[model samples]
Target: MAKHSKKSTNLWSTPAAQVLRATDDTRVEEIDFSLTPGFDGTKADAQELLAERGQVLSALQEKLYANGRSGDLRSILLVLQGMDTAGKGGMVRHVIGLVDPQGVDLASFGVPTKEEREHHYLWRIRNELPGGGKIGVFDRSHYEDVLVVAVHDLVPRQVWEPRFDEINAFEKELVDEGTLVVKVALFVSPEEQRTRLQERLDRPDKYWKYNPGDVTERGFLPQYRLAYQRILDRTNTDYAPWHVIPADRKWYSRLAVTELLIDALERLDLDWPAADFDVEVEKQRLANS
Candidate 1:
């Protein structure tokens, strides 16, 4: 599903990733998770337009980490599914802490280890991907191995039902090997996940981000909304697509995931990597130091 070309500068007006795209007529009971579709600003105008797009998303993530240190194989993973107080660690501390945490690679998949359940649940998600031109993020991924192993049967519907075509052929071989995945779910309702788990039990500094198993996983919220509407109906893939975001307005889901990561680093039309050695002989040897 590789046809993504839409970046003639847009901060919404139908760009919150194609208004939260998860098609095949996505109807997770008609999502209104606190509706803010295509945004009409205000949470102080989306925090002053996410602080004016954080200097164009930190100079397009430092020109995609300097074109991946000049080797440039391209990258961008970003998965982040949801539930339990669904703000995926406040979208990783406000939209991946606005980049350049050394080109970002986050990864946060909890509860597997024992050599990750003895391998092959994408072997610890292919050892936390993100390499060339980084920006990986997961936070709760591998679609939580088919939504918490098919909502708590933990594994057995003929082994998580052929893992939805082995996660769409391992995300179409990670977009035929140049990465660029970007999944996202974060719907969040159940009255805003019960007022964000009661404001994380009435905030004693959010009491270490409270988790009494997120109040026993909120009594299986209708089996996790029928296992996230069958994982947005069998892995909504158009070369790795799935955007659902409402997320009960945590500042419009961190300004729609910071405009879906600045429309995926402005559709990778990245430049600024020239200079293989002699830029006028290193400016005449640093102008005679």
Candidate 2:
């Protein structure tokens, strides 16, 4: 394969990751979920742009995979934490689906199984970490230990409270070893969530996608908001920062995530692995054969 040149710039003057990243002072209530921060284009424009960016993203991913195969220790872990109907699935299909499946490792964490429950909260998560040179995506993630567990009082305060620091340490260790953890929380307004849920009930084809528990979860939005605020304030670190993307507009969410993935891969500055054989000798041998 031919070597690809890294792109000097992206579509926006600033990368979407910087535009959407959460800070120590970030308040979930103050963010406008429907607003597209770094993009002024319409949905159609976004769709077109996403198609164009896909090619660049694909090339970079190939480089990452090739480097990994050649003994590079670096990898990426994209943690997506979002409420139901926040477009997590769509982002996966549109953005991640563009890359070579062999180069990506994806996991969707829901209710733990009997086997998963027997171990520590991060046990299942640890097993699913992506190997060197691959993109690992967690659809929902270990934060559920805090967000969902804390919201419903599934565990005592003493149990779930200490996980924030534990998670920070785990991520820092991963970073120190070579994993670039890109954590994202998708913010969707209640009104939009209701509309999306209702559409699932209204359409037969979408019925399979709907979950009854989503409604029950919707009722606890206030509590979830407070919990997420604390998560942003505490778990948002410089080494493994959180990018709170406004996910109300499906197209924008897809585009924003695509850019975020691009940024993560780009920072690696990977190149195609050098051929190990002598080119002239191999060429003469092949020609003679």
Candidate 3:
């Protein structure tokens, strides 16, 4: 392993992520996704920033993996929630995709299977949590139980109400067990989403992504907004914070997420695990052969 200087991160802080991070002081309703933090550069500039940040992210992930290779148990799990066409797939492809897939555990939750419906909502989530030294990304996570279930009235309010506390408790458990949980809500403007959806209809290659149900989902934005507001308010805890990303602009969201993950990984100050074997002796033995 080689040592890499930590210089790339300094350029990535622009479009302040603090405003997007939800805290005890945050008002989720006040968040405006139309203007998110990020550089107002040309497309090329955005690509350059992503490439640089990707390098830093990849290095940090490698270090996290190295630490775990020797038995350290700290890891990260990123929970992403957003409306359809909010760039969740893009985040996976461009951001987390920069790291080694073997070290990354990705799960996308859709309509629950008949079996998943029989157990606690968090059951499947627990199975997918990142192990020691890995990075996990959830395209749509357990929050669906609250957001979709509440919005669609899949479960009664009484049943869903306790879940807010249950979710908080579950996240706390993850943090106590040494997994850093990061929940993100990608805020895509309805107008931008319309444009994306329209593009899918117009482009034959993208038709596969256009689901007629999306038209119905679009009608529930107001209800979903209320659901998300409560979700952010009730579930934001000190141990596992939620970051609301402004996702109208694809480039900015990708940049913001990359910066967020880099910040989290960098704070760990992960060091390369020391070689477990005698390096010089092994080298000499190989030379003799």
Candidate 4:
């Protein structure tokens, strides 16, 4: 197990907080999100990173399964949020693919149904929370209340502003109940996103991923950028912190995520369930037979 040094300083206290506070679009762009250590998927060999991440994920899954059988009931919820072509689906498919399918549930939130829209924003999300001994992956999560809704102005400032607190409370409740929430925002540069979107348009198999609507959304990049900053500012908590991953390099992103998972699971001293035997009862039953 890798021993990570305790985080002596809060992320908010660092220079990253200055970037988060910058509301000016030009100034925000100056913030370097690539400084974090991990796989530089773009420059590094993709196959090597994939193999390393696979091994790490396999270990985590084994520990989780064993812990489940021992009745420890540890739950993990991973929230993946990013722009189109940010590799959210790919991360779920590649990094977590090796995990026992039965032990994990992947929830992808799309357009809300009429029933879902009728209730509070988090109503549908709460229904899908992972039970004890299970892992839940959210392709895009309730953070959208702040991200997309904020970008589109689908809700008023008064309505969405308060959601930050509501979300914090919701996550706190989950963590208090033995749920380990790991929120990840995959950050892909506009240039990289453009390249991926172009590829989607050019490739026959990926054509389905391209839409005129994406161009419309791309126009609101500034708004989404602001919304993303707000998400990092408000939702990052001690119990359920967010990891901002550089998604320009998909392999590096996967490695960083796998390392994060391993780090979390290592904190829980999991062990296989012990065997129990009733020697006297077995002997009596045998004699009767």
Clashes of each: 2, 0, 2, 0
Candidate 2: give its CA RMSD in angstroms. Answer: 2.6
lDDT of 1 by residue, 1-289 (tens): 1222233134356778788888898888778889888776568877877767766777788888999999998888888888877888888888788777999988899989898898889888889999989988988978788888888988888988888899899889988988888888887778778887788789899889887988898888888888888988888988888888878889888888877887887887788798889889889999998
Error of 4 at 237 (Å): 0.8
Best candidate (score: lDDT): 2
Q: In candidate 4, what are the lDDT values of residues 1-289, reduced to their tens digit?
A: 6332232122113322222222323233454544443322243444554465466567666778767766776788989888888899888888778677877878999878999999988998998988667778999999998888888888899999999999999999999888888888787788888898899988999998887888888899889878987887787777788777767767566666776676566666666556566878988999999
Worst 10 residues of 3 by lDDT: 1-10
Computed on alpha carbons, the lDDT of every model, listed in order, comes to 0.83, 0.89, 0.84, 0.73
Error of 4 at 148 (Å): 0.9
Cα shift from native, residue 171, model 2 (Å): 0.3
* Top model number, TM-score: 2
Pull out the clashing pairs in model 4: none
TM-scores for every candidate against the unseen true structure = 0.36, 0.95, 0.92, 0.83
Candidate 1 error regions (>4 Å):
1-44, 58-60, 67-77, 83-119, 123-128, 137-140, 150-187, 191-219, 222-246, 256-275, 282-289
Candidate 1, residue 257: lDDT: 85
Stretches of model 3 off by over 4 angstroms after superposition: 1-16, 24-29, 38-42
State the lDDT of candidate 3 residue by residue for 1-289, as single tens digits: 3233344334445534565677666655566677755455555666787887788789899989888878999999999999899999999998998999988989999999999999999999998899899999999999999999999999899999999999999999999998888788898888889999999999999999999999899999989989988998898888888888888888878878887888788767888898899999999999999
The best-first sequence of candidates by TM-score reads: 2, 3, 4, 1
